[model samples]
Structures are given as structure tokens and as C-alpha cells.
Target: MLLAALVATTALTACGLPRSGPNRNELLAGVEQTAGAPFAIPVDDNVARITAYEPPLTFPAAFRNAGVLGPDTINAGDTLGLTIYENVNEGLLAGQGQNFAVLDTVQVDGAGFIFVPYAGRIRAAGNTPEALRQIITAQLETQTPEPQVQVRRLAGDGATVAIMGDVGGQGVYPIERPTRTLAAMLARAGGISNEPETALVTVIRGNTEGTAWLNDLYTDPSLDIALRDGDRIVVKQDDRTYIALGATGGQSRIPFGKPVVSALDAIAQAGGLNTNLADPRGVFIMRNESPEIANALLGRNDLVGAQRIVYIIDLTQPNGMFFAREFLIRDGDTVYVTQAPYVQWQKTLSAITGPVGTAGSVNNALN
Candidate 1:
């Protein structure tokens, strides 16, 4: 009788404790009666309410305001193709013909100056091809009558951006023009090595930096911000994932195939709950919320000490499926489904039946 009582007590204890996660029923019950405790929100009526909550990340505002598009400006180490024209009849650089023209290719020196025949060394860097043409013409007109100049950029590596990380091609990509965008540079680098949904782009503009999902940059027009010279773009594969445990087809950490993953999707990705053993009322998403979100949900700040939150969803109810479809599962969240109480009874019954069957078989063999 004592053994039977002990067995019954053990079974009851198992039923009281959640099979997947820690038994937080007391904490949940406390919050249900009062609001000052740690939050254990049921996903029934509050799914839509918490949808407005954002992750605590300060996305920098330097990504906006695409600078005005301008012609390709010269940079130091650039090769400039200069075509100079002069009137031979009265020009210092006069040739055999009445009209004199000279085509010369010059490299901008370390000091960002290019040497001309009579203009000496002119500052070629920071000026566009047309701007350099005007400067050369102004200097030549002083000595050579009717000197006309045209400048063209041959090649420049300093005006380019560096692309590294998880891209198919990692190298220096030229800015080409002033209006070159982040997406344009990504294209020039052969896109990313992974799917857009599973990749993110980080733009390192000097000390300031910004990150956006590759899918967002492609879909959201505003997120496809402009790229700057000397900027380093890295296409990193997102290793973000959620862990699925307990009575589910899969219990390992699962990577998100899409940018946003819902509770229903998470369950489906885990091969749905283990139908035979899963407890319909014990589906949960466990995660630590930021302090701001915890305070907002609990309605009081000082009372709740920690931001650890557990969201429960009962799959047996009709409304549960609807709520689960809308409840988003964030990165690093733990999705767990508890085993049903009846499954424990099945285990006890099998244990008892195995002994009884063995005794009956031995007695029959003796008879």
C-alpha cells in the first residue's frame, strides 16, 4: 500500500511539473491574480497587444539622406586622360597646323596633383573630370592662346569600396558615381553566398555602422541606402535560430528560413507537436524580454525585478491556433511542448502489465 501511494504521489508530481520547461505555474498564478509580479503572459488576448513591442536596438540614422548624384570625381592615384587643344597660329604650344591638339595621359601624384605641359602641377584630386578641364584651361590660357582642355578618368582604385564577408566575390568595387547604393555594390560583388532571407548586410562607414537584412534591403526601398566611398560592406549569414524541445517531431535548434517566424511556423518547422504525447495546454515560448518590454507588459516597473518572460498557448482551444499564428517567435527563443498527463499513465500501465504478463506466462508453463 505504501509503494502504491508513493507511485501515485510520483505520478501526481510529474503531472504538476511541466515536462518541457520549468514549472512556473505558481509564478503564472501569482501574476494572474496580481500585476506586480514577473510577467507570464498568456498568448490568448495579448498576442496583438505585444505586437508593437520592438527589440531594443538603436538603429543608426546615418543610413538615410542619399547624397546628390554627381559625376565621377578624381581621387589620388587616378589616371587622367587629358586632351588639350590650342590655336597654332598664335599659341605657345603651337604645332605645324593652324589648330594644335595634344592627348596626354597623366597620373595624379601622391599629393593629389597632376602635371601638365605648362600648367605645372595642378590639384586633380577632389575635382571631377570637367572641373579639372576648367582648371587646366584657365592655367593654359595665360600662356597659350585659345587653349581648350577635356579630362577623362581612366582608372581609379582609391575611389572604390571594399566588399568582404559571405559574398560570392570579395574585392574592391568602384563607386563609379556619387549615387551608388548599397544594393548596387552588393550586385557588383556577385550578391551574397546564401539566400537573401538568411543573410544581412552591414555597412561600415568609418566609425558609424548600420545593419539591415538582405531581404529588407531588397523589399524595402528606404532601407536600400546609398553607399559612400571607402565604405566596407559585409554580407554576413544570419546564424539566428530558436531551440525547439520536448514533445515535438524535432527538438534541435532550427534556423529561421524567413525574416519573421511565427509560433505556428515554429511548431510546423519542428514537425508539429508530438500528437501522441504532447499536452495541448502546455505549448510555450520562453525568452528573456528587455526591461522596457517587461515593464510595459507588466504595467509596473519597480515590482518586476527580472525580464524573464514565458508565453503560454493552449493548442486544444479553438482560439489558440489563431493566436499562435500571430505570435512571432524571436531569435534565441525556446519553443517547447509538454508531454500529456495521459502519456504518463500509459507508461505506468505498461510497467504493471509487463510484470503481470511475465508471471502468468511462467505459471502456465509450470501447469
Candidate 2:
């Protein structure tokens, strides 16, 4: 009798407390009494009215202000084709009629200068082809009377941005068109090697640099802005992930397969909740929202200090699934499904039966 009573008490204690001490219910109950309760809001029809945390979908101002794609200015490493015409009778290079017309192909050097017979080394960088022609003509007037000059760009020195990293083709692509955009260039370089959701597109323009998810860039037209000269574009795999814990089918840090992962998809990716052990009414997604957004959503300044939010979803009702589909899951989010209250009791009952069965076996052995 004493052994049976002791086993029963132990079983009841096991039902009351979890292995790690407190269960989700106890933690939430304590939170309610001490603090004004975490921002526990149910995912429902009213949820649509509130602004929830979501991935950034808009392009940065630095990208939008990157200017439209247009013709590239003369830069170093460009090959130039020059034709100079001068009067035959009194010209420097004009020994005779038509012979005065001379064609010279010169390449601009590192100092942004091109060489002409009479003009010596003239600044060519930062000037248009027409602008460079005028400069040559002005310099020739001193040596020859009424000199006419025409400048043509034979070939560019491949003045293009390097599209490296996770791309189909990692090479230097020439910026041939003025209206060349980042998206257009990526297509030329064989698009991204990884899927849009798993790629991170980083842009380095001069000293300023920024990055955006490839999925966001693909969906938002505004993010497909123009690319500047010498811009470095790199596509890398996304490493940030979120954890799925508690009674979910898979408890691990799952990588976001895409830029914007919806709550329903996140749950599915986690292998769904453990049907037998999961509590349908205790589904939760824990994350921290900025104080500003939290305040705006709750419409109260007093709770502005609260950044940690436990968004609850009760899957017992059909409408709950609808809300789950709309809920957006951010990177670093934690999806936790509590164990069913009855599951705990079942475990305790099993523990009690094991001891009773052992005691009965010992009594039979002694008899």
C-alpha cells in the first residue's frame, strides 16, 4: 500500500510539472500576473486591421536615385578612332591635297589622357566623343589652318561592373547601353546561380554599399534600378534562419527558402505540428517587433517599451487556418507548439503503471 501511494504521488507530480520545470501555460500565467501580459493577440479577422512585421519590400533611396541608364562617358581604357583633316597648301600634316586627312587609333591611358601628334597628351576622360573631337580641333588650329577633326569610339576597354559570386557566369560584363539596370545586367550575366529566395544581392557603388534579398528585387520593380559605373554586384546564399521548437514535427533552425515566408508555409516547412502531442489552441510564434511598430499597432504609448510579442493562433477552428495563411513569418522567428494538456497526464499515468507492474512482479517472485 505504501509503495502504491508513493507511486501515485510521483505520477501526480509528473503531471503537474514538465521535465524542464515550467510548461508554456505556467510561463504565460506568470507573465499575466506580473507584467501587463505580453502582447498576446489572436490571429483573426481583427488581425488584418493591425500592421504586422514583414520583410522589407521597398527599394532604398540610394538605389532609386542611382539615375537612369544612359550612355557612358569617356573613361580610361577606351579605344578611340580619330580622323583629322587640314588644308593641303598651308597645313602641318597636309603635305598635299586629301593626303592631309589622317586617321589615328589611340587608346586612353590610366591618366584619362589620349595622345595626338600636335596636341600632345589631351584629357579624354569625363568627356563625350564629340567633346574630345572639339578639344583636338581647338589644339590643332595653332599648327594648321582650319583643321577638322572627328572622333569615334572604336571599342570600350570593357568599362563594366563585376558580377561575381553566386551567378551562372562570373565575369566582367560591359555596360554597352545607357539604360542598363541591375536586373538587366543580372540577366546578361546568366541570372543568379541560386533560387531567388535563397540569394542575397549586394551592390557596392563607390564607397557606399547596400544589400537586398534577391526575391525582393525580383518582385519589386522599384528595386530594379540602374547600375553605376564600376558597381560591384555579388549574389550570395542566405544564412539567417528561424527555429521551430516544442511539439512541432521538426525542431530545428530552418532556413528561409524565400524572402517572405508566410506563417502557414513556415509551419509546413517545419514538418507540421506533432498531431498526438500538439495543443491546437496553444500555437505560438514568438518574435520581437520594434517599439515604434508595436506602439502603432496596439494604439498605446504605454506599451511602447514592449518589443517581445507572442502571437498566438488557435488551430482548433477552421478560421484559424485562414489567419495562419496570412500571417507573415520574419527571419529569426520562433514557432513553438505546446504539448496537449492531456498528453502530460498520459505520460504521468504510464510512469505510475510501470512501477505498479514492477511491484506486482516482485510479489509474485517472492510467492
Candidate 3:
């Protein structure tokens, strides 16, 4: 009889007994006591109504001149078409490849400067093709009268940014003039593979990293940012995922995918809590460090302090519905539902027997 009882207890624990540790019920009650009971009146004036505030527009400096700038300057190993018009002879001298003698089609050196027959060594790094032409023309004027120089970049240098993660194509792409925007880069990579709107695009430029909403950049004209060389774009699809612990329904991961998720949405995703064991008043949402939303949640207080405390929400009363809707859930948010006190005994019994259930019938037979 003792062995049978022990085995039954273990099996119950493994299957999630109501009394094991801080099950759904006891945790919820403790939460209510800690975070104050929800307002009793259906429309309590004391309860603060969550107001919807428009998020301020954040613009990145990169996208200012999207189409304004022409193609970038040519680099070494890149093929080019050069034409030199000698005013004295009134004849057009053109070269197809780098061996063109009239225009001196020599490769750009490691120092980022190119050497022409009569132009000597001139700096071409960071200068556009047009800019380089003007420099060469000015230099030629010192030797040839009214000289005209034209430089066309046929191939691009290896300088490119890599787009990875949930994008359609994951590889390095050459930086084109019109393709400097984040959206443009994403399009070149064959667009987003999944969750185009919910995709998280991270720009990793050297050591500086910034994350922006891909949908916002597409819809909101103000948020478009210009991409730079060596930028890493990562798109991720992570919706339909929620964290559940303590006193919640199903005690399993819930999948939800929407433009925005609220505290209520999270609760609903977690099966709306185990009413039998949950403490309605003790609901909390834990969010990772995000400077953008920190100011609105904790006011102007020290962000470091506000970041440490989990945002507590009392759902015992009905008025919490409005507040829950106003509270926006960000990525990687953790929702914890507390349980009641009586469920603790059930947890103790389950803990003692949970392992036995996993060991199988052979172990029970041996015992």
C-alpha cells in the first residue's frame, strides 16, 4: 500500500499537481497580497485609466539622402570604362578594360589612391565617380588644355553588408546607390521570409547596434534609416510564444501572433489562468531592458530602478481590462501568474513522487 501511494503521488506531481511547490493557486494569492487587491468598484475613479499616447517619431540619420547620392567611387579589382577627350585633337579616346592606355586604367592601390599616366597619384577613397572625374579634369588642365575626363564603374568593389536571420537570402550584397535604405537592403535579399511586419531588423554597424521595427520603417516615412557598409540585417519571427509559470491555465507555452500583445492578451494566451488556484490580484509582466518604453512605464524616475522591479498588475477587478489593453507587451516579455496557498501541500506530495513516474513501470515492479 505504501509503495502504491508513493508511486501515485509521484505520478500526480509529474503531471502537475495543484499543490506542488507554488502551484497556480497559491502563487496568485501571494501576488494579490503583494501587489494590492484590484479595485472593487467596476468603475473606480481612483484607478488610473491607461491613456493611449502616440510613440514619438524616431528617425535615424542614415536615410536622409536616399536617392540624392549617386554611385560610390570605384575601387581596385573593379572593372571600369574610361574615356579621355583630348581637346587639341578633338578626337574621343576610349578604353574598354583596365589596360586602356589613353585614360591610364590602372588598379587602385591599397592606399585607396589611383595612379594615372599624366594625373600621377590621386586620392579616390570616399569620392564618388563624378567627384573623382572633376579632380582628374582639374589636374589635366595643368597639362592638357580644356581636357574632359569620364569614368564609369563597371563592377562594384567587395564592400557590402550581410543580411541574415529570417530573410529570404542570407549573404553579403554589394552596396548600390539606390539600395542604401534598410528596406531596400531587405528587398534585395528577397524580402523577409516570415512575419514581414513583426520581423525584427537589427543593424549591426561595427560595434554600434540598433533595432527597429520593419513594419514601422515601411509604413512610417519618418523611421526609414540609411544603411551603411558592413551593416548586418537580422530578421526574426518569434510570435506565438509566451512564458507561463505558477497559477495559469495549461501551464504550457502559448502561441500568439499579432501586431501588438497586451497583458490581457498574454493571460488569454496562457489559457486565462487556473481560476481554481490563481490569485486574480497577483499578475506581473517582466520585460527586458528597453530604453524606448521605460520612460512611459515608470515616469521620469531612475530607469535603472524601474528596470529591476517587475511591472505588477492587479486583475481581481473588472476595471483592469482597460489598463491591460493600454499596457503594450514587448518582445521577450515574461508573464507570471501566482497561485493560492492551499495548493502548496499538493506540490509537496508531487515533488516526492514526480521522479518515480518518469522511471517507468519496471522501476515500480522492482520496488
Sorting all predicted structures by TM-score, with the top scorer first, yields: 1, 2, 3
Alpha carbon lDDT of each predicted model:
0.76, 0.76, 0.63
Cα displacement (angstroms), candidate 3, residue 180, comes to 2.7
Which pairs clash (backbone N, Cα, C closer than 3 Å) in model 2? 69-178, 69-179, 70-178
Error of 1 at 26 (Å): 8.2
Worst 10 residues of 2 by lDDT: 48-57
- On the 0 to 100 scale, the lDDT of residue 314 in model 3 is 68
Candidate 1 lDDT over 1-367, as tens digits, reads 9789758866765565434543234435654664445456788656546744655322256666656335577887778787777765655554666466555668888778988878888998888888888888999888877788878788865467899998889988877763378887788888788777778788888899888788777677777777666788888887779999888898899998877788999999999988898887888788878776676776777734447677889877889998888888888999988777677667666665677799999999999
lDDT per residue as tens, model 3, 1-367? 9989877766666466444244344434554563533211112222223222335334345443433324665654544555667666433233443222354345666566877667778877667789888998888778767777888776675347888899888999877776767788789899888877567777777776666677888777655666655677777864546676667776666555766677788888778878677777767665454443354443544444324335566676666677666665655666777676545545666577466577777687899
Give per-residue CA lDDT, model 2, range 94-115, as digits (tens). Answer: 5555546555568888888998
**Residue 311's lDDT in candidate 1:** 87
- Residue 91 of model 3: what lDDT? 30
Regions more than 4 Å wrong, model 3:
1-68, 72-78, 87-105, 109-111, 238-242, 253-259, 274-316, 329-367
Count clashing pairs, candidate 3. Answer: 24
